[model samples]
Target chain A: MNQQNILFTNNTAQAIDTAINNIRPNGIFVLTDKNTAVDVWPQVKAESTMMSEATLITINPGDTNKDLKSATLIWENLINGGATRHSAMICLGGGMITDIGGFTASTFKRGIKFINMPTTLLSAVDAAVGGKTGINFNGLKNEIGVFSPASHVIISTRFFNTLQKRELLSGYAEMLKHGLIDSAATFHKLIDSDPLEIDAGHMLELLKASVEIKRRIVNDDPYEQGIRRALNLGHTAGHALESLAMKKGKPVPHGYAVAWGCIIELILSHTHCGFPTNTLRNAAQYIFSHYGTPDINCSDYQDLLEFMHHDKKNISSECINFTMLSNVGRINIDRTATESEIKTALDIFRDLAGA
Target chain B: MNQQNILFTNNTAQAIDTAINNIRPNGIFVLTDKNTAVDVWPQVKAESTMMSEATLITINPGDTNKDLKSATLIWENLINGGATRHSAMICLGGGMITDIGGFTASTFKRGIKFINMPTTLLSAVDAAVGGKTGINFNGLKNEIGVFSPASHVIISTRFFNTLQKRELLSGYAEMLKHGLIDSAATFHKLIDSDPLEIDAGHMLELLKASVEIKRRIVNDDPYEQGIRRALNLGHTAGHALESLAMKKGKPVPHGYAVAWGCIIELILSHTHCGFPTNTLRNAAQYIFSHYGTPDINCSDYQDLLEFMHHDKKNISSECINFTMLSNVGRINIDRTATESEIKTALDIFRDLAGA
Candidate 1:
């Protein structure tokens, strides 16, 4: 089921053309959000002659819009536009577009072919490789979805030119996490450099490394039954904070919350997994200084815990699960943490913020 | 992906118990309709101690309720019930229950194990063997779905005692179709017998043969890419008629519609595919006499053709696709039918009704 083939190209137009020629779909549908429709679609249109004939479907640009309603809209549009099972869909936007589009394609007519042309850095590196496709349901993130991979994931850094500084920083957080989880040297190098100032050549190299780390884990455990849990090192806490922010109607960007969660989980790793205190302290200092702290505090811990209970990784309702690290690139999955320990870790996170 | 294991038993209770013990899921969810809730669940509860602890979810019985709204309700219930990724769902009812329940389980928390306990003969012989799971969307039958097989499909004949005459006759349509599409001897045997009067032992043997026929086709092409389209021999015209009936609010049961559709298509098969004229005459006479000719006539052909365009099997708008039969157990898929040809076929169908 992990059939996604990755192609990194500087000339995205050539890549898109090549893919379309190979698939020879009966029809082509391009899915985008309002933001990508303006900023990114023109470039895609200019690059491939295929866009002239492809049907375009756009949704509102936000995580809140990535719901069943949006999926229904896409399905209806595809049906109305004469989409056959042999037709192909091109998801050309950020993570929200790719996630919802992949899900729509996976389900529409009982699964059609789709290609992901991830425009934002987060999607290109993180969402592109994994076969996870879904939409948020009942105020829960990714509570409804399937493990269906794309036919192709075409990555090009050209679309980054349209991204804002904040979005770039959000994407950088995942890249930073990949480095920390897989290679201490890469983490050190990433932290030493100003993420916002990276050249295209260097950024592509970083993207390849980050995507490779995720690809290896996902390929080994496509269903997330084992080693793939390691990829959730920061996500257990990250998703909780993200959900709470969304529920409160003051949403935090996903990567920023993840960077913050990594700091808290790093502390947990130090306490339970025999992680070196000095390494944790250094990583914590860099993350806090760069990503800054989220507005959530000790008062939000209970709400966050409520969110954690609904996390897909948890088997029982009693204890929260986390992927804790014994050392960089050496981690243990399904590690349980008590509410008291979570509060203590949050305290350590706060202390590191002040320090 | 074709991993479903079929279990045949007179003692369904013991089978349920064995399956539950083998899966040993963190939680069990039983999905049933109002009818099955009253007729079948008591048997399931008495048979398996697991049901004592399982959460039971019921939906209103009918094809109209098989939609995204119902799927959303099921997902919300599962989430609220503390159903983890390790939870398993038991779809215990007819085609409607199995179809929608399978969709709910397939998408819940990115899928969980689901076992099919098909109560009606239609589901046992047709829907049970196919890994097709879905809910109808936007006024279309099975418009949104996935090809995810169940962990197990448990068949039993005890539930047949509770079915109404019409319901029993409806399920018998598929059993008849399995014969028409795969074996002429089976078709002749079924035509000679009274479906409702068959003893349990004989009925079970017929079901095993029917299920085996469908299983071979599905295993050869689980995704309906090629040979599986043969299973859609009657469905092309059958679905169009069913959708029209549902739209007009004079809904016919699925198997009856398929039985009618099979007669119409058999005529098309004779004219277009060199099928023996006498075989078509005999089969048509049997189907018309047993199922009775639907109220459809020349007036309904336009509306039925309108429905056929959206059949999910067509490649273009110009011509509707049908799986034409060359002979019993021999089919040519993706065959095109023009409006004129369709009208002629309907004319032959009307002539048969009068005859």
Candidate 2:
């Protein structure tokens, strides 16, 4: 039912059942957010019989709710329910649920088996392929956490039925990243995709393919010590923009920020890593046409750069770590860009993106 | 310089230099408590040329200060000091220092390389052999933690020159348990030694042998999934006694409580697993001779029982997790004691120990 601990299924509840059978836990705890508990949890239980037996624990929705308070709630529930070393926790919903749930299970009694059932399109590709678990702390995103991966990453396309067109496009940004890092063929596949059509069964195959690229990279470097940083291709600048959006009280989807950031990164790649110019231009064009531009200006540059300085991938305080590329799949990892070059990239971003 | 990641060095600072070389870190952060900063940090720096370059981060002393606030201070210091992923942290002090330091290093940026220099006798024996890193959370001991093993465990006997006789004898309790679980010969070696002197060079050899036994057991079960319960021989009852002592404002040393608990566990072994009565009596006699037993009465039995119920080893709400032995070196792990049997063991403890 599950291959390489990633289950691609039409029935997410059945996938949870498969994970239960795999672990044969003494107890089962299901964690979801308030929104997902109402919209998704009931649907999951309707499809499978055994899933209803799991003790339901819900938190609030969004990244704001994915805090220590939520983690504490989950911990208290597991303790109250008398969870044992042999018990398993099922994290349902999106990346926020999986991230915090994986963290709690990893720490409670010094870790317990956990299965991640990622409901959002973004999480299906992003959170599915890696073992990064954490929660925000001290005004930092995932500032305190560990590399505690899920025992199983169960992705069900059926859950994407609730998503809007913007949500579909958000996930597609990461899929495009998988392509740009993998091969030209995968990149071209996404550029040719219609954003309004993840409902057409084509998205399932695309997601599986996208997950394969990240899975191969994550398998090689589970701790992100070296080559595994390829997954952080666009995340450096994207994260800063995401932070800026949050601070401005106009938050955007994670993939939207990533897509915009990848454009700047592609230019950095062309300048530093000798990435081909036409490919960079074409990629940026695709992003500009599909993804809405963030309200960023030269005034925001200083703050974005400040956020980049705080990136987790950094090796030294003097420089920000950049995962650049020479061409599709020709990764030039551990690269660095000067402050001036970063400004240049931003300038190019402003001109091309018309922001 | 280091064998099996554990360095028995005459110079503690030299061992830290060895760890730095092994990791080739971009930066170094040394974490110590206030007392250690006053005493051990100077000697460590006086012996080494390069150690002064490291950023020294000190926290308040004792388990009371080993909380989230302390962990936050460490994290903030590391962040402000511009620690990178390639940086290494040195935790130099007792169990509390190593515990919180290991935890902060493990979680900060999803873990950084950390070295443990257990300056105290208790820490060298207990913290060195295991990978348990934690901080007290929400009024519970080690409620939030991870099993992040140190990159290096450096031990220097010169640092033991600062310990009181009580501290030296306190550590002897765990060393005695190590001998009991290892073999009859090891147990006899400890019972034959005097408690007045750990500086006579015999304690160093004894400490090495004790650590070897624990090292072997820990290597086999790093995560404590199975086969690691043997190491929990006395901890279950020991921790309860330790808690009771803490609550009464008459705190006993950790090893003293463990020695007392081992006596009760030995009686349970005799009742359940046919442990030799003479061997049990001799072990109990050795404990009663050196380690002072805390005052306990039948009225306090309920509190002690409740404390045991809150032990981390328990798997279900119904029964407590116990690690009993059939004989010397023949462990009967995953065993459970009924509440009545526990009471009976306590009764025997009172009769023999004059509690």
Candidate 3:
């Protein structure tokens, strides 16, 4: 949403150079995960001259490590490294890294400036656009965080090559959701593209489109008060399914879970918000055909409901609140659906997926 | 220095009622310490009708508990209490409660609105006015925090009735610092007033003036970029001494430490910034006569220096940065002092204390 804070550049090195030159920080703290440190840091270091003097703070890669324990570790590292209020942190990696790193920078000395260089498709389009920074606690997603945006967000599609097929697909899922929420034409374009086969240039265009969709929504409502709820259209169901999958020990990638969630929620939209049934059917067919259905059944319905109850969007103790679409680009927030209606929607998804 | 967010009121209950009416929160969570839960909550509850349904969260009283552990416990309480983005937190105690509670409220669900009801003189003039929220980590004072202001801050002199003499004096130290920084007339007025003998009405007038002084500085520079550094005149050496005393098993009251820090820093002001020697001697005589010197001697100098090294204001690794006074009312910030000059300041403090 902070248009001036984000830079879309083909050459990340040049972007980093410009940001560092402008900030003129007293010191630099670079945060990365083991995965990024090995796969991505060399390229980043080679490009930015400042990397030689920066303190490298690495954490183990994965969502499981994105917790308070990791945050405490990062805080201690920043303190021991003598990071001052004038110091700037460079977060280079996926969502987990940026979330934790941004949180660390925001809380350290009552907040220092942070520059985000998102290395994954999910982070580039989603996390980097929003000033949301946090870590999970007590098995809840983003349970603890602050709404502090990075001073600069540098997005480069070259990091896409480092992503596995599943990782790439995970980010593509959000792109689909953005399209579905933004316009019918965008939705069709996303459905028609083979995510795994997209070239760097084309994928960069898609990433920019996805980021722009989020940027507009966030700019209109940075605090998620009203219009920004549209951004959570798939997240209501998607997050529940993701939490359920994680609980079941077969954690699905966020994008895949979101892909599955979109299919189920689209059916809910048709029933609750009078969305066109044809559009719902078309959406389900395309998403399921590409990502396939998550291995969830009627048995997982209660767990999914339980997870949904804890969703930050739901302010009430009863009845799940959802962002339902009357049609593509049309959203109705704070819509409550009954348990049976939700069950029926899952059943529709099961039938569509042939599971 | 969020002028719109703060309310100075004689009727605490009416202010709270108005704040609750305006915010229309989903729920209310009240944070207090064991001391306040017994001594202060009753008065607040009787005044504010909203206290009836609010969830009560309590922690032990003291600076020792103002750490990440306390923050974690408070977060758990908020999460378990079903606090949503719409929920409002009422921080009802001194600095420790507000610091931990404000940090908890600011971070929970990426921030919920928090109201501060400062119950101690120290908090009334200092913590309640500033948007500083934090918890100590790894033996560092306020090492982790955020610059997030409360939705409303309610200050009542009636709460001062519960403070012990030491607590009252602890706050008076800061009030003196405010006077010293604001004007020569204000400084003389503060030194002349007997903190212990002053009536509640007179004390309340002084409190308002102190708060106003801080409000002006913070308003001009909320993030402490320039002029706000003047407010840190005594804090540089005060925080270092406070931390040393805390580490030494005999934690001196904050105001007492600040009073001590003022005397030492005034000497530094004279040496480095050419502050009037006669004014420094008079100020030291008044402060030491009233609050007797702390037992720290030459042996504790190294620990004090070490603690100052970790002070958040320090932008570099070398010289200690201080806010020195050009005169009683004039201040020069970001001045570096050598170890010998610092030792000389301490020696002056000791000799004046008859050590």
- Runs in model 2 with CA error above 4 Å? A1-4, B1-4
* DockQ for the candidates, in order: 0.87, 0.66, 0.87
- Interface RMSD for each of the candidates: 0.7, 1.5, 0.7
* B155-206 per-residue lDDT for model 1 (tens digits): 9888898888778888888888888888788888888888889998999998
Retained native contacts per candidate, as fractions?
0.82, 0.61, 0.88
TM-score of chain A of each: 0.98, 0.96, 0.97
lDDT for each candidate structure: 0.88, 0.84, 0.87
Q: For model 3, how does the per-residue alpha-carbon lDDT over B317-338 read when each residue is reduced to its tens digit?
A: 7888888889988989889987
Q: For residues B36-130, what per-residue lDDT tens digits would candidate 2 score against the true structure?
A: 99988997877777688889999999877888788889998988888867788999899899999988898888888889898878888887557
Residue A39 displacement in candidate 3 (angstroms): 1.2
Arranged by TM-score with the best first, the candidates are 1, 3, 2
Q: Model 2 chain B: which ten-residue window has the lowest total lDDT?
A: B1-10
Off by over 4 Å in 3: A1-4, B1-4
Report RMSD (Å) for each prediction in the order shown: 1.2, 2.2, 1.6
Looking at model 2, residue B339 earns an lDDT score of: 82
Comparison by TM-score, 1 against 2, better one: 1
